[model samples]
Target: METESFEDKGGWVIDQQSFVVMNSSYIMAHGMGRPVKDAATTVKFPKTGKYHLWVRTKDWAPFPKGPGKFQVLVDGKSVGQTFGESGSDTWKWYDGGLVDIRNANIKLALKDLTGFNGRCDALLFTDDLKFTPPNELEALTAFRRKLLNLTDKPQEAGRYDLVVVGGGIAGTCAAISAARMGLTVALIQDRPVLGGNNSSEIRVHLMGDVDKNHYPKLGRIVREMDNGDPGNGNPDAKEYGDARKISIVKAEKNISLFLNTHVFKVEKENDIITAVVGRDIATNQERRFSGSFFSDCTGDGTVGFLAGAEFRMGRESKAETGESLAADQSDDFTLGTSNLWASVDRDTVSSFPETPWAMQFSDEYHIDEPKSDWQWETGFGNFNTITQAEQIRDHNLRAIYGNWSYLKKNKAAKYGKKELAWVAYIGGKRESRRIIGDYVLNQMDIQEGKFYPDGSVTATWTIDLHFPDAKNSKYFEGQEFFAGTKHIKVAPYTIPYRCLYSKNIQNLFMAGRNISTTHVAFGSTRVMRTCGMMGEVVGFASYIAAKYKTSPRGVYKDHLAELTGILKGETLAPQP
Candidate 1:
């Protein structure tokens, strides 16, 4: 018999005669980060039969074979109760049983003892008890094709009164409040974690209505998380500030969270949306749900676009909205994507890319300035961000690493040598497509402290713009970014309910950064806190609309008192 090590295949290696545990074999017994029972494999038999089976296992520590046993299956069925759990006294032995044969094909399966905590050796199996070429047997092409088809089709379905896309603070609150009102809700998020921009992925700090004099109800949800200030979450922290808060939200009876799922299509009937279709990453299955109303809390207005909702992108011109700061509007211009990185001190660095990294860039693309949150010019949608975060993450990594490499290798005088710190798993997005609502909030609205009686949200943030001219200036070069006119005349402004609805379509409400705000007003309302409140308003309105059997506008007109009462209950603080 020939022996092969498992470490050669980068993971476990399976062959016709035997299997080899490779790379990090210690994880097999003790396991890796998480105990993944689904990823574990088991063998079985077709029927009762006598078959030849060979087994081998390797461990960093001694194999705990005494009380722990490898389960064996015969003829697609389990045989006996269990085998091998004698409590760690034996090594390398074969036992033959006088079992009845019932099928032409037989399978042998090995299961590690529950809670086994050591490396496991690879097990060997053969029909004729002979080792041969790995690919001598025919490939299971038909089985694979069938499995693929099954995985691709959407299978899950349920009824929801309100479905909120995007699980940021806004979305989570939306789902929770709506469900509390006796409405079934589904919250879909593109990331694994919640809190949107405050999520570990985006790493932005969470902020909301704080009295400064005292805490207000607006921050009730976020305050549950003890991650220090709601705003200023340490980007380098391993976990999100509100990650646990998300767990509490998920535990709520009415809210169903679908993480790492993207809403690709919206089913509509006339002006009303019927169902939202989402895709699951693990199983590659699509999920559908029927809802009375839908909230586009995705920040980018993904649902609005799919529902044929009219929207806008980039800075709007004065000709369109009469906003003084509105520049020459163009669809190609956008608020740009964030390239996030976790900074660390040189003394405590790990997983830092070694020198001579493969993705180096020239001096032209280098950014040597020592600053936190350096914005790097990104390639335009080169990879599918929804499915592969690592794809976009790698681009940010390359941009960051390449710039550092360039500084050290070429421009040491202006840009001194720097140590490797940390990197972000994914980049954050500041702006994208904006859904055009009944109102297009302009910069002047913010400057004038404009308030609409129908306003559902109030925001106070500066109209920060990234200038194209500053793209490569000495003051700002190589994804060079600048914050336009801080401490400007902009003040607290109200966001109208009309601005949350599609001008062309009815019964759909948008929230978060993607709502019907001019580029300037979006700068303020886009903040996570305001967005969260926006979500709450939309969510409550959705429930009320369902209750009254009326349009969103109808709810605003007929049930303003009740709608305001619901919003007030959900922690929308009165503007000072």
Candidate 2:
């Protein structure tokens, strides 16, 4: 049992003579501050049996202050995990023991998880003195072994009738609805906050029947988000009403909130999801949750996809679905992203811009050009949205600054040298991957005023599609900006429950812009208010499945009357 180390000019080393190396094994550098991968140096196991893995840290310098994290992987899957505790010396070593080392290639990954920032170390592999690598036969037996640890222990397995995978407006409502009806629920969220897009992170002002003159049920949740005060022209203040309301909802007792956590994998037993793997991003800890029923309200359909739920993405061709509004469809080409900006009244600000702004203005910044305005930031409606967001956000900042700069440099416009104060921290994405559901809502449904007695949510926006050629049209026809084929804003349409469940997988649901809808129908259904309602609907459905000990399909069928009764009672105000 000897160790050998070689140093290259690149400040990293490897032990070529280790006994653990198998055919496909190689040492590679990944993450911050490491040289590229090196060629393979194979090591043949003398005789196969159980083996222990010890990973040594190889850093350029002594250990710095604070804790650090690194990952050791077998084949490509993560196995051994280590953390550097405070007060540890530089280049500290940690041992990953008794791993069922069966993979042909075992590698170590050093990652920096600290906020202050540092680089990962090169890995030094060594052999276990007590045991040896397992043989092919032994490895086959080990492969069948399930890796169960305390981290994966369920606090309550199959105990909760339902599990909701998001804590947004829809998730919260669903959890409350189910819990109030005497069903156990597990509410999961990836953020510290419960609200999804409308959370404080994105900071979009809430809209719906909540603030409207006739609808107060729409306002029920929003009023809870208010500060209970009055303000002028400020949508957040008028909409939220008071800050105290937000505090109360955050303290809701029925919801078992797991924020700042992400669902990574799902385990299936027969056609049912037995457990879900979750990771707490902040702590780097992993856990498992088990429930009889599950609802996916991640907006992006993340959970549903992982659970092997059947879902679709992007628009289907008209020929395929007879969706009328569907055109020649492609994949990965979703809606645009919006970098929302808030304006500060110049009268309250004490500073002025020290530079010029705009593209040669003559006191008139308003134009019919295919562009955006900072006065009222509105986007998320562009072709090539992924790439365009980066361009639009940057251009938006530049335009605002450039405009202010021009005023300061010019004598007219009387803006008195104003400049942009700040940009939004979170960029809102209007559309992305949509989950294919059992039924995809179509454009004709909205046009014909079709109604599903089982409809859980309604959408009122028009079939607004951004032009394909933004830069060359009457506006920027070829540019990546808002371009709608038409605006059919006349009628409101219902989103059915079947369109949310997976077409192939059982017990999985999706909400938000990702739900099953044609691109045209999505343009109308993609709004946050509608998404919130969808969320609530999914949440309630999940609760019913858990309570009745049935599947979501069963709830949509035999229990339709009961489900509708509950939804109607949850109504915020009397319907017009």
Candidate 3:
């Protein structure tokens, strides 16, 4: 038997899911009826013979009709029918008939039948047709490991002084800061590109000021990596500056950047993370990275989740956090995720087909033209943006297409010449699990400007939280698909070094939205530029931890002076 996981698909996304523990990561095509190119991988047969192809997928909805469906193709020939058309709402394997193998080289391809979302966890080919794959997790894991020749315990990819997970602006800055200090570093990102939300995929324009904060050189790397284009919403590659960011990371000598790698496992002992295991999304292979220090730049706090670090989700009550702006009583309600889009103006007339399956807006709220900024957001008021990521994305996509359809079908003359420039398949998230650290910064901290002895990076953005659009909320109630933000301004405040390290997990340092902060303070700290500065501070602190061979918390408790020196751009000498 031979197997291939779509996680290894280079030009694809590994969307977040809670209802499914998929054998492979799945991609959601958000183009509505327009066909989007899917993922592909090559396989070599040990011996040429007939092979029965099977795919691991699900209908997602069993009672009604399934929205997700796709077909299998071998050597450019269809295996006959779409596999995800009919199956249990739960995950299951489906047969794709037999194909005679004439050549050693094989090309496996997926054709998305439904533009909504056609998911496939893995593709399997077996010599014995009766040998059905197992549905259970343990059995399936062993089956795929053996079939794919993957080690249950991954082999070491390399040893690094520091390993930064999540290749957003935060992770990028961390790697550069540490590597420039002569520390060997590894930066692992799930997506093909860096910049996280600001990447071409998500397109959130970077906010906040650099050099104005306590640390002048904190966002130096951010500015260097940026293409300097302030435009948003499907701007040109030059505007997004993807190439420049990649070039900067590639040029670093002390850094080993791993792109398209999903970090899934960790090895820890006595609260110290010894190594991290990342699976190459395109090949289903694994690589283990050993490090003395680790940074969680993942906005969702995934590393903390895998490592058993203490974290907080949703809002903290006004009583618990003592913030007047917080909810009277807290529950799991975050800012939610956004799927944004834009349109292009051409010399000739163009048309967009009406999308019948998209999310709806009231006739008055129906979008006529295109949007090119961050305001085109959705998924709020108790929406599970992390677990129900795909569903939330679909809701946004539906809203996009449904509104466009309303304009095209009812008011054609106005939008007849406009064509879709881009619609992000990737969803931009604002908040998730904030891993517990030595200090939980709250509204009081930012408002009072309480400075710590270990104060490092400064936060500049206002406390901004998104709720459902008031009018849209009136119409859709619980399923509103538009965002309305409430911004509370505050003076620039410093984040303590204690806020960067995991409280329970010793070696793990966290940056970005997942850093230790109350919901209200997270509003200001969650900005990309502020997160980038957190990375810069964490990088230097990581170097101190390695230099003194101490735990992350030890950097503050025992070596604050040296860490403070780095943050203040003082002497290079270490003091412990």
120: Cα error in model 1, Å: 28
Give lDDT tens digits, candidate 1, residues 433-545.
Answer: 78887778777777887777676666666666654334344533443332223435466666777777677667777777888877766766676767766766676677778
Ten contiguous residues minimizing lDDT sum, candidate 2: 17-26
Model 2 C-alpha lDDT per residue in residues 160-244, reported as the tens digit of each score: 6667786666665556545555566677776556655455444454433323211122324433443332221232322432233
Deviation in angstroms for 155 in model 2?
8.6
TM-scores for every predicted model: 0.66, 0.60, 0.91
Estimate candidate 3's alpha-carbon lDDT, on a 0 to 1 scale. Answer: 0.77
If ranked by TM-score, best first, what sequence of candidates would result? 3, 1, 2
Give the worst 10-residue stretch by lDDT in candidate 3: 1-10
Candidate No. with top lDDT: 3
Residue 190, candidate 2: how far off, in angstroms?
2.6
Segments in model 1 whose C-alpha atoms lie over 4 Å from true places? 1-147, 150-153, 207-219, 222-226, 230-235, 329-331, 346-371, 374-395, 406-421, 468-487, 568-576
